[model samples]
Target: MDTPIRMLENTDEATKQTLENVRKRKEKFDKFERYHNQSIWATIILTSIFLIYLYKTVFTVYSYSFAAMFSAFVNDSNNLTFLVCCVGMYGGMNLLKEKKDKAEKEYHDLRCEIVDRSKDYWKKEDEWKNRHLVFEVMKKQYDINLYHEKK
Candidate 1:
């Protein structure tokens, strides 16, 4: 009777320890998931803004070219205006390109972070699995011991 009582206490303690480990793992995974989602959203927003800027710049350049061609037939004054517009358009395009490059760099960095976090999560999960396996083996041994003693 005393042996059975001690065995029950040990089993309860093991269960408690396992539950605590599972809770910790769940919290860690939740944090990682939130971080990954936020990073992805930020990258998406940045890319969208960059694409919109590129589209606007291209349209402006096209419009300016059309105006410059029409002005060429009208007057010399038109040539100066056309040249200025062309320069402005080119400058705008260059600025947009630089911004796009920066956004891409940020996106790459975020992706690397996500990968690193994912690896960490997997590593932790593996550790938890191994620990659980060990606990199961130990539990089996305990049961076998109890059975033999009873016999």
Candidate 2:
């Protein structure tokens, strides 16, 4: 597929369409990534809240000792509900993470294909490198001329 690099060398209808496809794919990839990150943060925050609540309710009630807190936590039947919720949240987050990874992979694959199809990519890169080298040489010569003129 003709990508942006190819378009730079030669712009046409095909390259335009390819650019559009790249744009759409990028957006989809970004959306999936955002959703995955948000889900993970939500899971972490909710788990933290549950922990805080459990700590306050159990530790305060049963005394500050580790043994007391552990006994209370293990014996409390209602703690099962919190456990289930944590497990469910973690599983859901994993699913979202997987989807995000897939989207990222697809995006990178598309980018690689674009680069491969754009025949002028290496040529353009070489041109830039040559230009930079020429500029550096010119700068050094100018500095030398200035030093000699001052002397």
Candidate 3:
């Protein structure tokens, strides 16, 4: 489900805040990942189109041989501009990938932090509950109230 279920109505505020932060970070990571993939596809499509255009122009006007077409594609001044643009696009895609990686790391770190906090909290709660049970046993067997609060 898209909407989160509130499983624990009495959950501590700190835990709730941590969970909210983790959710936000995960959403950001997902957004970055989507953008990075889109950028990669865009670069691939544009490069393919550019290559097709170059193939038609160079093969028809200059030469039919693969070697000659390759040489013409490399040496042509107008082709240099397209190559530069491709390099620029590649650089931008790399930037998006870097951002996506960073967001992923952040989201994982926050998620782990929340998990650890929950584990620690549950461990302490269990310990306290066990101690409470021991106190009840002592009170019944030894006539001692270990849980008495001092005024």
Candidate 4:
């Protein structure tokens, strides 16, 4: 059976090293979360503005073309093409939004995991420190006795 001192020493070294690694990962995760959120918001706003402009321009043109074609007793195929283009643009924007949402969710999950791991490592490190203090006191008392016995 290993003594308390030996066990404490072993745990102390391992915990300290793991704590450093956890701290680094926590920093990285936080940075990524911030960046991903910013990107998502920017994409949403830009896509909204683009869709509004596209609707205004395409609808106005289609309405004008349809009125002219009706008066002349002619069919307008150009209006159908414009409608298809508008629908395609809307579909593309929706796909991009979904992808961005997924990425943002992933970043959030990663950030939470890093925070939880960091907290666990800190708790273990504190426990190790307390045990090491007790071991040090015991070792000091033993050393003093040996020193006096030599006299």
Separate clash counts for every candidate = 0, 0, 0, 0
Could you tell me which residue pairs clash in candidate 4?
none
RMSD of 1: 17.7
lDDT of 1 by residue, 1-97 (tens): 2233234322344343433343343344445555555555555565555445444644454566867544543444634554455555556555555
TM per candidate comes to 0.34, 0.63, 0.67, 0.38
RMSD of 3: 13.9
- Give me the displacement of residue 13 in model 1, in angstroms: 1.9
Provide the overall lDDT of each model, using Cα atoms, as 2-decimal numbers.
0.43, 0.61, 0.65, 0.47
Order of candidates by TM-score, top first? 3, 2, 4, 1
Model 4: lDDT equals: 0.47
Tens-place lDDT digits, model 4, residues 12-109: 55454443343344445555556656655665665666556545655555666766535433244544554565566566656665665665455445
Candidate 4, position 22, lDDT:
34
**Residue 24's C-alpha lDDT in candidate 1?**
41
lDDT score at residue 57, model 2, on the 0-100 scale: 84
Worst 10 residues of 2 by lDDT: 142-151
- Can you write out model 3's per-residue Cα lDDT over 1-151, one digit (the tens) per residue? 1123123333444654655565666678878999989989988987887788797879887775889888888887878887788888899999999999998788777655544454453356655355445434434543333354220
Which regions of candidate 3 are displaced past 4 Å?
A: 1-8, 64-78, 122-151
Off by over 4 Å in 2: 1-10, 64-78, 120-151
